[model samples]
Target: MSEQTDTAAVPTPEAEPTSTPAPAPEATEAADVATEVAEVAGAPEAPEAPEAVTEAEAVTEAVTGAVTEPNVWAAPPAPPKDRRGLFAALRWTAAVAVFAAVGTGVAYGITQPERTDIPGLSTKDDGRWTFPVLSRPALPAGAPVPQGPDNKDGTHYAPLTGLLLPAPEGAKADDAVKADKDGVVSADAFLEEYTPEAREKLKQSLEWDGLRQIAGRGWTTADGTRTHVYLLRFHSSGFVDAFKGCDTNARFTGVSALDLDDVWSKAKNTQMNSTTLDFPGAANFDGTDLSVYQEVKPFLGEEQTKIGCLRTGDVLGMVIQTRKGEVAPVTFHQSVILQSQLLS
Candidate 1:
């Protein structure tokens, strides 16, 4: 008998039975490789059930010749673990710390004074006079300074009294200079520096020459040294040169005759620094002409006299120092240098 075959209707209970279960899926080669790499790299253990599902899917795909997707998607590679934000925060913190330190330093510097002004922080002390701080007076609105390119005649437009050097500290004033409250003296007062016989002639000459004004300052130190400084301002530099009061032929009251101060020339040449002769301003006597003279032997009185003549621009400066035994050269040089600096 020929039977018609219908595969869909036939009962294949012996081929596959529902009461019997299929074996669990085995670990695939890909799962074994992933586990070994994870252990070596210190990664957390993966779920074992997902591995079994992947193996089963792979087997089905091979047997049925159709692609089967894996159960686990591997979480899309975890997005590469972004760390740019953490580095940016660290950099900002470092920048803030640097700025704060700089701000603190600036504040401290603004509040503190100079180290030289402090008592213990001052520099080494030399044998220098304690004089007040020196500052040039303000000029007239349209006037130029002496020796400036605009002022060809080298005229000093500032007040003659303002150009005078102030007395040093701990000095007593002298009444012999005959200076007024404004430090101004008369032609007769300035002529007192010469001998009695010369005063009348000098007075007549001062009135004829273009003598504008005279400013005088005198002080006595604790060591009995008398210092007298006089500033003679003329109408122009030419008149300053014509004044004979400070020339080599000039005659002082107490000094019989004048001789060139060899000590001054030697000190200037050697930049003298000795126990007896110390010249701090020896190298700084520019912008002026200096002539120093000492009293000849057999002085008129028991005291010795020295003269310092400084010609700067339209002014003639005379510094006279007198002492009982001898006038200190150091003090005389200091006075001349300081006066020249003011004129310059």
Candidate 2:
């Protein structure tokens, strides 16, 4: 009995895995290992790369997806159970940071002042004015600035009278302008350089007429030739006078005040024969009391500027004018200027 039991345990050719038409031993070994691997209890799942989304888009998409989908839908898609979903949040945060940085740079550049090559801030220079600009003229350039004399030569020559005072900016000029278009100067420069008293005195000056008798309607230097002076005086009712003498309705943007002064201001050098007989106040071509200014006024053009000053009592209706610089007296409205002197 013992021998028979031993044979049963030891024999049966040790049937190796009951190999059905068994392959080589090595192949059998490989099959066994493969079967073991397949039977592993659990293997980790591969991590997936997160899809990037911007904050704004993610919010919009989330809202849209929520709103468009029925609340009744399958439990709201299980709330992305992946803990790594925090990666989506990080991606959204990075996208927002990039946009904010770009927007900040543009705003800073726009609010700054442009760089200037000028010494003090920015000063513009455009020189092509035969007359004054919208701005006033700069300081007068000549011998002794702000000279107390009206004459270029600087003397009592013709008592400074009826000369236009530099008008305060915005002060109307016979309804046409504040002043004859003057040069370009700053408001500070104007006030500092020009004084009211100087202007008042300038208003007192007389143009062209000197300390001599302007005789025979035309004055003659020792040379026999006489000057047939055509003087015209204009009255200021309003815009009409600024037209010089053309059309009463004509308009003139300002002509040049100083340049005109240049044209009319004469040297106080010439001397004449007579300083007697109250220089005829206002005269007509006929020289007969001549109350009518219309007869001899053909020479006065519309849009031309008239010169005069604030009047004193004795010089009613009298004004001075110069059509050309440093030339002879063009016109002096004696009556009006003299009348102005009667300012009540």
Worst 10 residues of 2 by lDDT: 286-295
Which prediction has the highest TM-score against the true structure?
A: 1
lDDT of 1 by residue, 1-344 (tens): 99978768765567644463332334333345455556645797544434234445656676786754443323223222234665687799999999999999987865596556666777554445667777678889999988788887778899889988888899899888999999999888888889888888777777777898999999988878888999998888888888888866887878778888777877756765543344345566556788888887898888998898988888898999898988877677777778877887
Q: What TM-score would every model get versus the actual structure?
A: 0.63, 0.17
> What lDDT score belongs to each candidate, Candidate 1 first?
0.76, 0.28
Residue-wise lDDT of candidate 2 within 172-274, one digit each (tens)?
A: 2222111223322222222221234343332222222121111101122221212112121222212112222122221212222222222112211222112
Q: After the best TM-score superposition of candidate 1, give how far the Cα of residue 55 lies from its true spot, in angstroms.
A: 34
Best by lDDT: 1
Task: Tell me the spans in candidate 2 whose CA falls farther than 4 Å from its real position.
Answer: 1-77, 115-344
In Å, residue 299's CA in model 2 sits off its true spot by: 16
For each candidate in turn, give its C-alpha RMSD to the true structure in angstroms. 13.0, 25.1
